[model samples]
Target: HSLHCQHPNTNFCILTRPNTHTHTHSMVDCHILLYIFPGQGAINPALQFAKHLIRMGVKVTIVTTVFAHRRITAPIPEVLTIVAFSDGYDEGFKLGDHDAQHFASELRSHGSRAIAELITASINEEGQGHPITHLVYTMGQTWAAEVARGLHIPSTPLWIQPATVFHIYYYYFNGYGDMIRKHTTTDPSCPIEIPGLPLLLTSRDLPSLLVPSNSNSYSFALPAFKEQLEYLLDTETNPPKVLVNTFDAIEPVALRAIEKFNLIPIGPLVPPPSLDRKDYAEWLNSKPESSVVYVSFGSFVVLSKQQMEEIARGLLESRLPFMWVIRETEEIGDKLEELEQGGIVVPWCSQVDVLSHPSLGCFVSHCGWNSSLESLVSGVPMVGFPQFTDQTTNAKLIEDVWKTGVRVTPNEEGIVNGDEIKRCIEMVMGGEEFTRNAKKWKALASKAVKEGGSLDMNLKAFVDEL
Candidate 1:
């Protein structure tokens, strides 16, 4: 293990003589620390994963930015401890107001040093329970692994997206980026083939971060992805195990695509139902079975005014009972009042509870991985309207690979017009095939995550390996 040094403003780096004791690969000796970015999508699964580890008698600590820590309003596990450190923005960092690259850099520098200090404290304080024997982190947090390196602690990356996105990013950084860029630059819809993936892919199907058109907007993403893969590759021995939030049965091909790393499937790390599910449960119980369409674009994406208008018009035209989660309804003008009469619109609601409701027939989504996995486990079909990041690829997987839903195509002006939205929702709702596929995937997801199942066995195996 190594020592920690303090810096100027908001640092608590402490160093002392660590207990000079030998350790074994037992669950009792294993204490894990998970570092996550300030996103609901990432935090949900990380918390769930922590609960699983805690159940197995391992100590777990969750580290995040102060701004993120302040925003967590739900109750977490009692045994689990969460620590917050500054990310240069104690309040919050707005993407519209600041540069993405600057925030990312600050996150890395501050996060790495802060995590290093925590690991140092746990090591030196003999009564602080146990030393953090392992470090597990989420995507876009490659810097956490570097701290693990300095301290000689075992580390792993918990991939929150589907393993297919991991494969695409690997190839993108490892010399195949130019081909994808060339095709995407010319025509996004043109057919292309990635070396490892069996399915025929298009430039349109790739992660928006890798697309050239989005370079100016999501400038920080591709480089961050490249840095993650490069770090894993640069490790000569003891390569950190890759943990994905998908089961093997679903993504058999992509999970095994990379020869260099062993990608472990220990998930659909979907958490149990939240505490405040009573109100939504009552609301959904009042609606008829398979009668409601659930619409939500997960946290980050800010839809264009034209796009929002189209969505409102589409929902009204479909005449289906819907529950739309519009955080900033002011952006949509007075359309909220009209829509509320036919359906429901709220700033926030529990997604898991909504998806699991019997009344929910079709999901109008941004195709974020968390939402996709939740919909899959709930047996709900989807109308995928992806906004950015790995969402397009996840949508592609949902439609083409999983066969659980249909992805929508935006019109010439890049707006998913009301007619198209209405058409997709109607098709998804009316089709028996989609429903059957959804139920089948739902059963498979349950089997993988249930007691004595693949996921349970995999988690045990992972702990043993640690």
Candidate 2:
């Protein structure tokens, strides 16, 4: 027999449920299949969300690429099953080495077959496991919903980006593509006003995908998003329910912007403070509160040597104790050797833990949605050095809307220099305004996750449907 846990809480989803045999009624277990984006940024939040499901007595099975599954170092959370399907890249898919378009097509073809097999196998078991009753997919995972459709299970997309971005993309595909292109085609400084978004966005504030001059516009992800949104457009009676990783107080306007979508803000889905020992924790502990700079560009971004050197110069100039995560070692030079001596320089660390540390005053980041949310919830301000896709949009949110950070711009040479980095870091760290805003948002985020809070209420409502 499956686990029929009886632990109860004020929150409904946090309680465990009875199995078919335990309950005389016809109610079966609710099993959700979460198909996640393979990247570290996407995988972490999805896992956190799954943990909440398990607490609620729901069964969760995560399906991801074979390579991604192997790369995860953490012990898999108890009771949540992790399953892998090949993306035809059993080893790994390096963007620099592989073609993105071909990979997306292969993931769709192979993933669909594997999911069908997985679902079928579960059905055959007698009180062994539960068949998937609902499907939730992340970015670039629209094809999973197609499988859910064929299998007759309900599906919803978990949009990991800000709700504002989802709205921009919806507007683009539905009618505003040409007008947006016209506004962004020439100067990036041109103002492009999108309906429903309270603020007028410049091309700088837009996703690089919508900007014709930006390199990201040429990538396969744009088309993948287009396909995802287009499929949602055909529904008549029911508006597509999109689960976004943002909270109400932070994105009150954006959440209510689109009537076409039942945009559910069940997030700031940042994980709780980690208790695991970090090698740099002791050093961070020694520093004064809100005195150190934390720098990371997430897993994928590779900056030019000139830019890296400039950043190194700036951090050194700022004269703050710092922790920098430098993944791409080949492109960097000896300038970072100095960084390792006085500061902590590693390939990676527990980012959520680091950000939440009291010593962390400022975050120098790529403005990835995960990173941005983590920084905000941790009560840390930022110096945004964004690159590509949703990073630009998130940077705008950080600097303009949220008032919790500053952004750095590249000069004529297409590089953000040491001066710019130092300026932003010093500004963010020195200003009480940024820190105050960060603390304000952090408080709201905490309230949202408390029992019966906005995020908790939304997630509970969704779970109730199951």
Candidate 3:
């Protein structure tokens, strides 16, 4: 006799059938084994996608770092198994540390060995004895893909940004490296166009890795990103499978630009908002539809004190009901009180929940990919105030490609004044055009994830080949 437990949230079910008892109708019908390798910020979406794989009768296991294990705030699915590996930073990696480059080297060496051992252990008679057939890895951790190749296991790279950014990086390392370097070195403000992308990207619109500002602390990781692309090219016979976090209708050109790799768009991978209510629910319920502006810069990207103050003044001057998320360390002193009078301030809340709320009309964002996708799916307009990395790229996509939002331009002093923030907010919130565009993208994004959609068919084809 066997017992089955179903998770109310995710459709996947947990089965306690004996190994010898194989039934055609069981939840564990398929014998396909999937090993997933995802990095820090990318892990959350990876896990969500992995659960869907489980629902499709694929046995999935996640291999990540100890720091990432602790950082995951979402509830894990009952059928999935997660194993943590050491990245040489068991305590956690800190910014501005001298060991930045050394840390990258350590992660590559130690992580490769750890992943190799994990694969071996799973197959060995003394261990769980499951044979892993396919491996899927995310960006920057190319070493995991190398491990899979060494084991003769089929694997793919999961690109976690908009396809346009992938095309930008591909062009930079391939033939346009020197040209891009020249433009950024002499003048970052100059607009330079890439081969496939229609937009004329300024240095501000490029990834910080190619043209890092003095404040960009992670320039050491640029070589690692380059290495990832190099490894993708190393596989000769087959077009390397690149799983991108985008949809067909949104970035059709960028997704199909590279002929050498199969870029499968399988995302907007953010998990649906949980049913368990949080503290902010009541306050959000208090506001009317399309009235509140939700502001957040994400977990990373520490804003400067001066920048924070300027944003504070902007929100206050805008006079819109808002929700601002500030880190505990960031202090604005007396202004916090005045700002709270008109809106709410919290360290964190369920971002998806807030964005999906009827009260949310505008998002004042730093334009990270995860946040960008969330805003798109939620059908909320945005005021893009991009700070670093792919954020500038995402902001450009929002303002130009998608036209679902407006980007905030900083002054000559490199600070976005309160007046400028207010102007952008009014433009996004006051216009029906932005709202209509947002809803249109939201429908398209939702359609991609539904059954028999592009993402579903793509994922199924990839898994079936294994």
lDDT against the true structure, per candidate, is 0.84, 0.81, 0.79
Best by lDDT, which number?
1
Ranking by TM-score: 1, 2, 3
* Model 3 pairs in collision: none
- Over 329-443, each residue of candidate 1 has an lDDT whose tens digit, in order, gives 3378778789888888888888888898889999999999999999999999999999888899999999998888899998877889999999999999999999999999999
Sorted by lDDT, highest first, which candidate order results? 1, 2, 3
lDDT of 3 by residue, 1-466 (tens): 1334443333222333333323233333233333333234586678777866776767776766666766767876665666665666776777765477777777777667666765665566343445676678877677788788888776777778888988998999899999999999889889998998888988888987888454677787677678888888887477778888889989999999889878999987878877888888899999999999999998777777888888889888888899999979777777888989989999988899999999998999999899999999999999998877788899999999899999998888888988899899999999999999999999999999889988789887877766
Residue 432 of model 1, lDDT score: 94
Off by more than 4 A, model 1: 1-26, 238-240, 275-277
Regions more than 4 Å wrong, model 3? 1-40, 126-128, 212-215
Higher lDDT: candidate 1 or 2?
1
Scored by lDDT, model 2 comes in at 0.81
Instruction: Write model 2 residue lDDT over 52-140, tens digit each, in one string.
Output: 66666777888788777766665555556676666778777776788887877788887787676656656677487677888888965
**Total colliding residue pairs, candidate 3:** 0
Return the number of clashes found in candidate 1. 0
